[model samples]
Structure formats: structure tokens, C-alpha cells
Target: MSDQIILTTSSHLEGYRVTEHLDIVSAECVFGMNVFKDMFAGIRDIFGGRNKSSQNALRDARTSCLEELRKEAREKGANAVIGVDLDYSEISGGGKSMLFLVATGTAVKVEKV
Candidate 1:
């Protein structure tokens, strides 16, 4: 394996064969929504503009989660991650809401097929 870890959404990489199946690794990121973003949610359509606030939040969370996932896999002696999954959830209460991102995968050791 190289210095960088290989990550794939599929169960296996085409050119590589699994030699050891490590433990399942996961990472989470929580993104908070400001009042302004929520209040202007409906007005965005009137101005015919994209929801930059939401987009930024999603992008940031996704990046954080994936990076953390890679770190977790690497720590467990895994050269690659297979069967990756990303899940998003909304947690709201008391008129406030936050976006939660979770990334999970099976850490594995792989070699050339």
C-alpha cells in the first residue's frame, strides 16, 4: 500500500483484493444553522439564487467527516476503506436546528489482485 489510503463506495476495489478485514470505522460532523440562514430560507427562491448557507454547511460537514474517516482507518492499520457510506440527519429542538453528518466504512488491508 502507498502513503495514501484508497477509499471506495463499492464493497471491493476492482484491481485490489482484500487480505484482511479490519474493524468498522466511523466519523461524525455536526453543523449548526444560524438564525439568518433559517429566516431567509424561503426568500432565496424569490431572489432566484442558490442557498449558499446550506450548501456551505453541507460541504464543510462532508469534508470534515471524510477526512476523519480516513484518519480512523489509517490508525487501525488499514490501507483502504471499502463499502463507504455517508448519512445526514437533522437535529432540531427549541427553534434551533443542526445538520449531522456521519461517515462509515469497513477498514481493510488490500493487495494487488
Candidate 2:
């Protein structure tokens, strides 16, 4: 069911016509920056270089959020989700940091045009 669902950032999917608009669906996924990773990131900021760990963490969060969004759309009897949007933010204080990710889209029923 997961693989059968289509997701798009555009308002509509090409070659597919929206027959019924279900409802909006969203999912959230969060990741915390451990002290070890935070230390490495700080060092990278001083050295001015790429941060592979940070990038990977962000990518992983996105994947998880989208996957859950897909599941929600499926449960709503939607074959696809259009106008997909992904948002990310950071929360930090007291020597601890976390990354929050939210994936949202409009669930719809679609068929080949």
C-alpha cells in the first residue's frame, strides 16, 4: 500500500486526474542532536567544511516523516497526495538540541487521465 501511493510536491500529478479530494494529512518526525554530534557540528562550523552527519540526520528525518504521511493518506482512502510540503526546524536550549520535521499534503483520489 505504501508503494502504491503517489506523492507530489506539485498541486497536481501529471497524467493523473484528481477525481475526489479527501482531506489534508500530515505527519511529524523529530530527531535530537546528541552531545557527540553537536560537538562535531561545532567543530565543522569553526573549520568551515561539510557536515555529513548533520545532512544524513536531516535526510533520515524527512524520509520518516514522508513515510508516515503516506500511511495517513492511505488510511483516508487516497491514492495520492498532492501539494506535498516538508518543513524543518531546530529547537535548542540547555545544551541539548532537536530537529523537528513535518510533512503535509492534501489527500486525493486520482486516476489516469
Candidate 3:
């Protein structure tokens, strides 16, 4: 992770001016649900309550995706990423379920305004 890189969902950053528009960068992560978690989540679904397991998985995935995004931006010589977006999806195949998280943003060089 690059501490110098700023990440934001907004298109504009306060106290910074975009000097150059680099390119769009994206990162994706996939997490597989274990059998025990699936069972507990199913139970929680039936009870109509929050599923901590799934929530934690998503949180970790988002964090990892953001880290990857920051790395990509740094590699591109970008000091900030704006217009960031996150997407989540689930895939079920071969009797298994997996969660996918994708983060995208426009890498840009920014200077203090």
C-alpha cells in the first residue's frame, strides 16, 4: 500500500488539484465461503438477522481490493485516485459459493492547491 496515494469515492479532492489524468485502474478480489460459514449464514438467513461471517468476508475483501488499487495507482505515478467505485457479486459453482469485490478509479497526479 502507498501511504502517499489518496483514495476517494468523490471526483474531487479537497486541498488538491489534479495536474494530470493518468488512466483507469482496477483491482478485484475473490473470497470463498467455507462450509461452516455457509451453514451459519444459512441459519442466520432463516432467522432474518445479520450474518457476521459474510460481512467480515466482504470487509476484508474490500480492504484487499483497495490495497491493490493503491498499488496500481502508485505504479502509475499517481498521487490520488478519484471517482472510485466498488462492486460486489457472488458466484455459485461446483457446489461452492464465492464473493467477488472489484474496486475501480481514475489514477491522477495531484498537487497541493
Tens-digit lDDT track for model 3 on 4-112? Answer: 7899999999998999999999999887767436657466444457666666667778889999999999999998999999998888889898878899999999888
Worst 10 residues of 2 by lDDT: 39-48
In model 3, the runs with Cα more than 4 Å from the true position are 35-48
- TM-score of decoy 2: 0.84
> What lDDT does the true structure give each of the candidates?
0.86, 0.85, 0.85
lDDT of 2 by residue, 4-106 (tens): 8899999988898999999999998877768337757566544447666666667778888999998999899999999999988888899888888889999
Model 2 misplacement above 4 A: 1-3, 35-48
Worst 10 residues of 3 by lDDT: 39-48
- Say what the RMSD of model 3 is: 3.0
The ten-residue window of minimal lDDT in model 1 covers: 39-48
